[model samples]
Target chain A: MQQRGRGRIAYPYIIWMAIFIVVPLILILFYSFTEGDIHNLKDLKFSVSSYKKVLEPIYLKVIGNSFVLAGISTLICLIIGYPVAMIIANTDVKHRNLLLMLFLVPIWMNFLLRTYAWMSLLSPNGLINRLLLWLGLPKIEIMPGKTAVLLGMVYNFLPFMVLPIYTVLSKIDKHVIEAANDLGGNSVITFIRVILPLSVPGIVSGITMVFLPAVSTFVISGLLGGGKTPLIGDLIEQQFLSSRDWHFGSSLSIILMIMILISMAVMSRIDKSPPEEERRKI
Target chain B: MSKNLIELKNLTKRYNDMTAVDSINLTIKENEFVTLLGPSGCGKTTTLRMIGGFEDPDEGEIFFEGKLLNDVPAYKRNINTVFQRYALFTHMNVYENVAFGLRVKKVSNDEIDRRVKRMLKMVDLAGFEKRNVDSLSGGQQQRVAIARALVNEPKVLLLDEPLGALDLKLRKEMQIELLDMQRSVGITFIYVTHDQEEALTMSDTVVVMNKGVIQQIGTPEDIYNEPINRFVADFIGESNIIEGVMLEDYKVSFDGLVLDCVDKGFALNEPVDIVIRPEDIRIVVNPDEGMIKGTVTSVVFKGVHYEMIIESDKREYLVQRTVMFPEGSVVGMNVQPADIQVMKRGDVPCSKEEEEG
Candidate 1:
């Protein structure tokens, strides 16, 4: 009886979830399976055309581009972020919090403002090119291209990768590392055999955190890509607002959700597998 | 056993302003099971870590088999440690955890498997090779830690209170098992623990430490029967310590009674501390026929004996025997001449301060 009363506190949250989350998802599902005026229930008839339209070659390319870009950005984040996390975790307690706070200070500002700042710095005749000219170097084109979008994704998502990995690295028992040293492992071997494998869960979560956001980010691609490198997110946005095609947009959203779910399932499987299996894979 | 395997000369380690291990000298022989026994913060673990190459001493030298090892890192040293918490790698299986040392040296897989299996069998963890380390019980994890350290077959093994986390019965069982393992392996074992009983049960030489200094180092029997100072006598077991004056060789006076004792080499009429073991004192049936007379204050039943507190004219005495003396009963206590141990008073000021603190 006590547990039941305590659980009653969650009723408001459950109602909130049903109204804000479940209802929208159900409407999207209904839109994805039927083609009609969504505002008029009389004309809303069951159909498979919206789902069939998602199989077109043009849409598939956009989805592939989204995966490829997100995958590359996540890989870069791991490569650069792992060492940064290790360095942060190994720092003395007096300075570790300061270093972590410095890393997170930029994130406290508005996301769009940070991206806009990057845009100003990377634009032609902007801060970077002006500095390059002042150094007597040739002018380079980075903004209004795929390179700028990739840079934006990496810059925005890098902290997501570092924080989880740092958390895991710091929580690892110092005795375990000492034991590795006692068992005749040098620093490099100890890191490879003990620390790296132990931080796999963090790496997995970091990948998910970076990849999910990067894939569906329409703002960065739109601002930096100059409407040239259209990703799945941009296509879905255009379908809803510009073309006024909610059915197709709803279908694309469902497909993207399914792809994310699949990737998450695969990531969790990797996380659950033993370190020996991971070593064998390497 | 005759050959000195490790020698520490004036080894000292200080952390900031506090000296954790003071300048001390010690020699550990080959095939000896030596235990560094002390209470927490006594620097026993610091000394062990210095020997293991985990911590470099701030002053002095550490020599292993006649070679200077002060600059050697822990991984480069030919020594392995079974950590106090059993520090088993949770991400690995039992087999992988035990085989880690061999794998680091790039040993052949067949050789690693054979040695790991044999070590597991010795620790009675056979058929547990594929099990995850986190799935094992605390005692089982301890055995794995032992097996992991022993698999390398190093010249010496450092165990920092390996059985400290186990239950009482399991700890007792592992103490015997560890003794057997040490004999079979025939390697010098340097163990550290705060548990005096464990140190006594398993070590050939017990080093008693207090306040970053060696209080005494001797066989368990010697340490128990002939502790060198007031600190050693008081720390080792239950004892009645009383201030007394040495009248001459073989004679001491305390509680208004002069008695014969075996200790000498002190200045005549010098004030000294006298230690009398509880069990060494005999309660006489007739109060008038004893050297010291007292009234029993309290009696407690301890599994194998009865402990009674007797209040004499000078102080209360804790006496242990097979017989129970009821409260308020008048009793007389008699002690053998050899049982009265005389020690120089206030040998170390830190321990005195510790007592007061």
Candidate 2:
């Protein structure tokens, strides 16, 4: 009886999603295929000029730079976050909550403020460089470049990577690990064979979380990279706001959306098929 | 070679102030199916974990095949466990889970395949090599767990209530199958369970434990027919424990009535506890034909027999009889001499001491 009424309760959420998610996506698609100001679509003419403009060498380089930096930051988050998640998940119950809170506390701060903080720290004469100089180390230039942007991206997205992996790791049945040991598997072998494979869902979600925002981040690049490294997000923003070219900006958004979707599909497919096939194999 | 395959000497484990397994000394012979039977918090699983090297005792030494194994890790020790929940790798298929031990040993793939298939076949899961472990039923998962443990050919196999998840019918079937598997594998099986019937049905020796101490260790018949104290008698099966006194050699008295019994170790006129199995008491229609007379207060149909609570003048006796005696019916109950077991009152290490002292 309760189940019959449950469907009605979800109607509000369905309507909200249609208005917020599906309608906006359809609008973007419609704008990407037409030429004119998006708000004045009454005289809009359908064309491929925006898509043609997206493949230009300059915009293509910006997209490539976006991919490279985002990929690097995501990889770094995974490397740093997996062990952090593992340690937090494996900690005793009393300390686990505190450790997780510590990892997530930075996320509560404003995203732009966090990036600006990194900008100050990565400046040429900042605290980190001063510390390096005091230690008789060579001072290095970091800010106003890809390194600074990467640092900001990694710092901002790390908690996203850690939380999901932690959830998966902690939910693992401890007896399964003991069973592995009983089967004569050492710690390393048990982790590789049991723990790691079981944690794939978390890892995949963590990757998506870190990668998606990192790919389209305009603020981090603007604040830290000082416009020296313009990502696709910056290009799209320039077209929409500065250059007043909604068609080009909408096309970039469409491409970014497609890329995110394709990657997610590829990742989830990678996550699902191998485990299924391995289990199905005799 | 040592006669015992595994020996635990003065093993004790404590969690905070509460003792989990206190000074347990047990020796397991090779190829013996021994069960650690007890109540839920009775240290049976703790003792099994100690043997499996999952938990090290706070005080004591463990020996495996006469070699000191106190510091041996679980993976290093030749011991495998079938956990209560089966603990089969959900990410792996039946074949992979079964072949896990061999693959860890770095055995040849061909040999691993052959042995995994053989083990699966032995467990009656011949065609389930490709099935995911979570897709299998409770009984099938249990079989997979057993197969995974046995395929390693460990010297000892520890089972921590592996059949507890299954239904009664499946539990019974698995109990017999486990016994058969133990016989065929010829490895020491140290099974843990709270169910007395499962322990009795499968184990060659049953170690009855309670509140961190072994109450008694004996064969099923010895445990049932000659339980050392009230705890073992009550834990193993239903029994009518009446306070009694040993009158002399081969005689005891309960409820102001003298009765002939086989036990004779107690001093003359000394306090004792008498245990008579419910099935041992014969319910008769004539009051003059039996030793004690009572009116049936309640009768529960227990499939094979009727469990009737018969109230005599001093105490109530649970009598199991195939002959149905209606409630409120006056009936006579008879106890044969050999069926009555007498033991010292302060024998169990449980609450019996607090109660009787």
Which structure among the candidates has the greatest TM-score?
Answer: 1
lDDT of 1 by residue, A1-282 (tens): 999999999999999999999999999999998888888998999988988898999888889999999999999999999999999999999999999999999899888998999889989989999999999999889889888999999999999999999999999998899999988999999999999999999999999999999999999999988878899899899999999999999999999999999999999999997777325423
Measured against the true structure, the TM-scores of the candidates, in listed sequence, are: 0.96, 0.94
**DockQ, computed on Cα atoms, for candidate 2:** 0.65
Per-residue lDDT of B13-117 in model 2, one digit per residue for the tens? 999999999999999999999999888888999988988888988999899999999898999999999999888899988888899899899999999989999
What tens-digit string does per-residue lDDT give for candidate 2 at A147-175? 88888899999999999999999999999
lDDT of 1: 0.91
lDDT of 2 at B118: 95
Give TM-score, chain B, model 2. Answer: 0.95
**Lowest summed lDDT over 10 consecutive residues: which window, candidate 1 chain A?**
A273-282
Correct interface contacts retained, every candidate: 0.75, 0.83
Q: Please, what are the lDDT tens digits per residue for candidate 1 over residues B107-209?
A: 9989997999999999999999888888999999999999999999999999998888889999999999999999999999999988878888999999999
